[model samples]
Each structure stands twice: as structure tokens, then as C-alpha cells.
Target: MNRRNLLLCATALAGSFAAAPLALAQDAPIRLVVPYAPGGPIDATARALAERVRESLGVVVIDNKPGAGGNIGADVVAKAAPDGLTIGISATATHAVNPWLYSRMPYDAAKDFVGITQMVRVPNVVVVNAARAEQLNIHSLADLIAYAKANPAKLNYGSGGNGSAGHLAGEMFKQRAGIYALHIPYRGASPAQLALLAGEVDFNIDNLAAAAPNIRAGKLKALAVTSLEPSPMLPGVPALSSLYKGFSVDTWWGLVAPHGTPKAVVAKLNKAFTDALKTPETKTRFAALLAEPVPTTPEQFDAFMASERAKYQQVVRASGAKVD
Candidate 1:
């Protein structure tokens, strides 16, 4: 675990901060570790929920730790003492996909962390730089396929990192389209979006929330949403399944404490977060980000995780993605 773990003094936190008034920020704040860079979908969600959770839980802080496809930060939480003070805001990539993709994982996704509650689910969109899309005359998924088929390796895509949901989606796209494209992996989703903005890659399948501002600003053109149905956030963007049947890939964010965290503590944390999600301000903010709040109980979240992990296990195996 990182030396920063010692700074939180997590075990002593309840005694020091729990009794403090909620209005007055506590001396020892709960650290909400985010395994991705700032400005991405997960970061935005974490910061938003952190404010609301603080009101009920005393004080909460967001800690960004991006690397190894989110395992670095997740491992930090996994290894931390099972105090409620240390928890991580994780995504599908971190909790479900990484376990199957990496040969030697830093932590066990299912066993190392106790599920608190899922915060929200954000659909992903296939997008290209507006200028490039215009130049290439790619107006939709069909156009993208035609272009890629005509130009083989000329087409390229960017992803958050190897074994990330974005990476798997890109591979699925190529496999279904019968086209070849080079893969460019970045440290985080926001960095991948930056590369797309600079035209570093031809396209990217990015979370709609992270790409919404740019797409609305015309910096990027959303061609298709990676869901069974079209995204309500981007109603005009067609669903990828329209082009290739049964296509789906949506990313989500949620909270989890280290394994052995008391069930009572987990329930308390879940209540705080779910209460935050029900707030009007938080709801409006999450809508603006194009994420739907989905607060779930620990048992429900555990089952959801199992189903998602099983679904992505097949995806990773079929994609032949290896993070050895």
C-alpha cells in the first residue's frame, strides 16, 4: 500500500471525526480513492457524491490514483485496514474486467472489497473528432464501417488503458466490423479524450458523460452509443447494436470498502451515498453529466458484480486481451 494510507489514520478516524458536527468539516476526513485521473466520468461522480456523503458521514475527500488499469488505487483500498475511512470509487473496469484481463492481479476483485452501493451508470458513445469526422464524411456507424473497411490499418482508436472497458469495446468493434485498427492506450479515460480532441487517434468509444460536453460543443461527433438501445442523453446518436446486433458496453461507478469492513459500517456508508443520490441538486448534477444514479444494497451490488464479471470474462477471453 502507498505511504498515503498512513496519513489518513483510518482506524482512529471514527473516534476523532465521527463525533464532530457534520457542518464543521472533520480533522480526519474519509478518503474516497478514485482509480482514474481527474475530469473523467468516475472522478466527476466521486466528487459529486463526496460533497453529499460528507453531510451525513462527517467529511469525505477524493483521492485520485490512476494506473495499472485502476488496480493501484483499488489495491490501496483492499490493503487498507477495514475501517470505513478508506474506500474506493470503482468502475466496471476496475471491479469486473481487470480480474479476468490481468494474469496476476494486485487484489482480488470479488473478495478483497466489500460492496457499499453503486452510484451511477453511464453509457458509452463511439465518437470521432468533429473536424476529422467531417473530413472523412463519417456521419454514423455505417459510415465508420465503410471508411474502416476501405482504409484498413489507417483507422486507429484510443483507450483509457490496456484491459479497460474502452479497450475491450474497441476490440469488439474491430472484430465485428472486420476491420483492422491500431490501439493506442493512455493512462486514463480523460487522457484518451484529450488524444481524441487532438486527433491523436481516429476515434474512441468513450463514456457519454465524459464525452458529452465535447460532443455538445461540436469538438467531437458522437456516431453511436454502445448500448442495446440509443442513449437518451444523446437521443440522436444511434445504438451500435443497430449496426451489429447484441452490442452493448456501459460503464458504471460505485463505492467499496476493504474486505472485512464491518457490515454495519458498510450499511452506514450506503445510506449516506444513497441519500446523496436522492438529493435534488445531486440528481440535477448527475443528469447534467448524463449518468443515472443507481443506489444498490451490498447484497444487490455483490450479485450485480458477479453477473458483470461473468459477462466481461467472456468478452476479455474472446478479445484475447492479456495484461501479463
Candidate 2:
């Protein structure tokens, strides 16, 4: 055979060998653990990602084991075999906020897992029931603050249980705005959103992906997003940072494997999901949730996780959010 032909065959073989693990991942079915219950944003993202990632990762299976505000499911992934098969979909709640909010954590956020790739970032937004907004004349963050200050304890904000991002954002808003409002915690975002729709609560700071439908349907009115900059999904909506300089809060989700997983496996998994994130289909599906696909390298994701935990530690401490 010609030298060129020989080299071509060798190159093809090497490429196939490199992709062997991806094929193995499919055959073995990578256990994609969503630390929260099914039907939530994280779970939905996992399911969507699984369909596309399967083209690379093989048949991915979502396993939901929600408890202790994501700690229970996270711990399960942390202790799983370091074989890269048991990867978890972690969020700000599991990796960043829980360490500071919960009195006793089931697993160490930074130490127990290896960062894979950040999947998506869901902007948190402050929404008031449309009727309540008109009744209180709260059209903007500033207006809400003024009304809240004027009527302390009369207005209430709901959250997806204590220590959730919604709760922390509310507390941070209170601290930054220097306003007082009662906090009512619910079992989950659905209930909190329902409470707002039912007029049980005046407002809520919730994930835009979850609240965007309601806002578009006119069931709720979005005042601002809890991000440093504006979100395209919520056009014309002011960023909370615009109102409270330096104020920013966004809930992000990522993939993580049990620590000690082979670096090659980590690299394969990262490529699979990051590649999935680039697809137009995934982008369209994620848009439905009002989430933006954010793909990052393992090292970058690790650094990002550190910054998130550090930022939320103070918020949780200041809010005095306890999940004991």
C-alpha cells in the first residue's frame, strides 16, 4: 500500500479508538442525575440535553433523587463510582448556595465532584401578578422598593422553599433596597408561582425560564432580571444591577462527575454536552425555558463554581437562611 494510504488508515483507526469511550457511554447508559425533582428547570434541561447528548454520550438516563434542597441527590452522585458513568446535573443550589444555606451538608460541593461543563444559565427575574402590579402601582424595582418600604409586612414575596435562589434573591433585594417584605417559602417554584397567580403573594423573584411563560401570558409582570446585564429573552426588562449597582443573581446549571473519574472520560463527557449545547435544536428548546446555553471548559467551570459559592456564602449568611 502507498504510504499515504497507510497513514490515512492509521488516522482513521486512531479517530475511532478515541471515540470508543463515547460508544461505551452509550452502551453503559450514563446515569444523568438531576439533583432536583423531575419537572423543574434542572430536570427539564437534563432531559433535553440527554436527547442531544445521546448522539455522543449514548443513552443517557435521568435519575431524580430530590431532597435536602438538592443535597441528597448530589451526595448520591458524589459517592458513586468514579467511572464517569454517574454524572450529576448540578446547579447554583447544589454546588454554591447549599454549602452556605444548609446547616449540615451531605457532601462537599467543591471537593466531591469534578466540574465538567456548565450547561445553561437561567436568569432570575422579579415578577408581580399583573393585577397586583396595577393595584400597588409597582412598575419598576424602584417603585416596588418604595411601596415595600411604605407598607412593610403588608407585601409578601414567595420562594421555592428556604435556601433556594428565589429566597436568597428576595433577601438580597431586601438588603440592597433597604425595604421590608414578608418572605413566604413554598415547597417548590410551581407553588410559589401559583401563590403569586392566586394573589396569595404579591410577588416573587423566580427563574425567567419558569416565569417567562406566565409573564408573556400576562399572568405576571416582569420588573427586572437579576443579572448584571439585560437578557435578550426578556427584552426591555431592566437588570437589577441597573437599579442596585453591583447587584446580580443568576441560577446556572452544570455537569459534574464523581471526583477521581478519569480525565479522558471527563474530556469526552464535556465534549459531548458542550457539542450538544451548540446545536440549534437545543438552543430552541432551552429558549422555551428562558435559559441561555453556557458552555465552559472544566477548569473554567471549576473557577466559576468557586466564585459562585463565595458570592452566595455571604448572601446566605446575611439572609440567615437556614435549612436545618
Candidate 3:
């Protein structure tokens, strides 16, 4: 072959070799880890996004690693090779609250991960057992606040755990309203909710999705929603912000990869997941779960997480909650 032709041939061959690994990477299954157990809103949302991104990103498998307030699973992601194959869930706890709440952290919340896209946000509702509310003459947020003020520590609230979102929200509520309520921490949100249903606790600032059924069934009286504005899911329920100047606490989670993942890979994953999050299917499914899809760029998600961490640092310190 001529020298020019030989040179072109060699270049083309090298180009094909370079493209082979990229193609193989696309075909490989991604391990999308959930930092919680299998059967919760976080898991469910992760699964939904996985299915939606399949056509673009290939098979995405879920790995549930639940323990130590999500640090165990998150640390798996943090310690995983940053090849984009081992992305995991990042929630308020994993990325924001856990750093301050835990005495020892498995991973640095801000340093160990790269944000892909924020998935969804589920507002919390302050709910009382229907019978308990009736017996206590608590019909609204004002009434509930008054009762708590008049009878200090007479009312009690149940949360998933000491440092879970529910517990932090309850603590913030108490601080804002200038009232005290005994906190009862259960194993998980389900158990805490069960405690509320059985009247074992007077009230709970619970996930709207989990509490919606009982609220509709007239078993739980939703006094207020923990959002800046009233949630459409709970139309009649006023926002706690209306009563307290700054009472907004809710559940949110998203996708993340180990820090040091290439910017190109992070962008690719972000585009795939954010596109899926914007779809009508995702919206409908999230609405059924009482969540709102929040698709944001990596920079935006990072900023959001930073603000959250700063906000929760104070909350956690004020609550004096810590895990050994």
C-alpha cells in the first residue's frame, strides 16, 4: 500500500479499537444501589427510573444495602470504582443529614460522590391518629400547637429513627412552634407509622405517600403539610409554613456516582436519568407516590445538596441527635 494509504488505515484501526470499550461499557449493566431497604419510596422510585432509562442506558440493576442510616450503602457507592457502573441513591440523609448526625461517617457526603440528577421530592404531612385528634380536641395546626403548648410534653411523635427525616422535621416543628413533644423512634417509617395508627404516638410528621391512604381512610387526620405551600395531594391541609415562619421539611433523593467519575460519564448518566424523570410516565408514577419529580443539572443538584447540608447542620445540632 502507498505510505499515505497505510497511515490512514492505521489511524482508522486505532479509532475502532478506541470505540470498542465505549460500546462495551454501554452494554454492561449498571448497578444502581438503593441506600435503603427494598420496599420503600426510595427503592420504588429508583426502580422506576431504572426501567425508564433502560432503552438509553441499558440494564440498570438495583442493589439494596440498608443499614446504619444509609451510610453502609452510600459508602459502597463512595468506595466503588468511579467507572460510572456503580451509581447509587443519594437522599437527604445520605448526602445532607448523616454527616452531622453520625459520630463517624463512612464517606464524606460532599466529597465522595457526584450528583447526577435529583429524582423526586415527597412532602411530609403532620398527621394525628383520627381518634387521638378527636379526643384531644385537635382539629387543626393551631389547635395542635395550642394543645402542645398548654400541655407540654403531653403529646408525643413517632419517627422512623432518631436521625431520620421524620425526626428532624418533628424537632424543627417543635422549635418553630415553641412547644415540646416527646419523640419516639421506631425501626423504620413503617413501624413508626404503625405506632401512630395504633395510637401509640399522638402524632407523626410522616411521608405523604405513606400517610395518604390512612388520611383518606379517616384513620389519620392530616393537620398540616410540611411544604412552603399547600400540596395538591392534600388539598385542604394547610402548609405548616403558614403557621410557622419557616417550617418546611420533606423527603428527596437522587442518583449519584462515586467521586472522581469522569465528567463525561456523569453528564451521560445525568442526561439519561433526567430525560426519564421528565417523561409523562415518571410524572404519573411519582404523582401516585405523592412525589414531585425534580430534574436538575449536576451543578444545580450539588448546590441543592450543599444548601441542604447547611440547613440540616443546624437542625441536627439543635436536636442533639447522634448515632454511635
Error of 3 at 16 (Å): 8.5
The local lDDT score (0 to 100) that residue 69 gets in candidate 2 is: 76
- Candidate 3 to native Cα RMSD, angstroms: 2.6
Instruction: Provide TM-scores for the models.
Output: 0.81, 0.89, 0.92
| Residues 1-324 of candidate 3: C-alpha lDDT, one tens digit per residue | 999999999999998765543454478999999988898889999999999999988999999999888899999999998777889999999999999998889799999998999998889999999998899889999999999889886889999998888999999998888999999999889999999999899999999999999999999999999988899888889999998877779789988999888777788889999999999999999898899999999989999999999999999999999987
**Model 2 pairs in collision:** 26-58, 209-289
lDDT of each: 0.85, 0.89, 0.91
- List candidate 1 segments past 4 Å from native: 1-29, 37-40, 150-154, 186-191, 194-200
Candidate 2 lDDT tens digits, 22-104: 55665788999888878877888899989898767678899999878788899999999887779998889899998988777
Instruction: Record all residue pairs in model 3 with backbone atoms less than 3 Å apart, i.e. clashing.
Output: none
Task: Please list the residue runs of candidate 3 whose C-alpha ends up more than 4 Å from where it truly belongs after superposition.
Answer: 1-25
Q: Please report the TM-score between candidate 2 and the true structure.
A: 0.89
Backbone atom clashes (below 3 Å) for every candidate: 0, 2, 0
CA displacement after TM-score superposition, residue 100 of candidate 3 (Å): 1.0
Candidate closer to the true structure by lDDT (higher is better), 2 or 3: 3
For model 2, state the Cα shift of residue 192 in Å.
1.6
Clashes of 3: 0
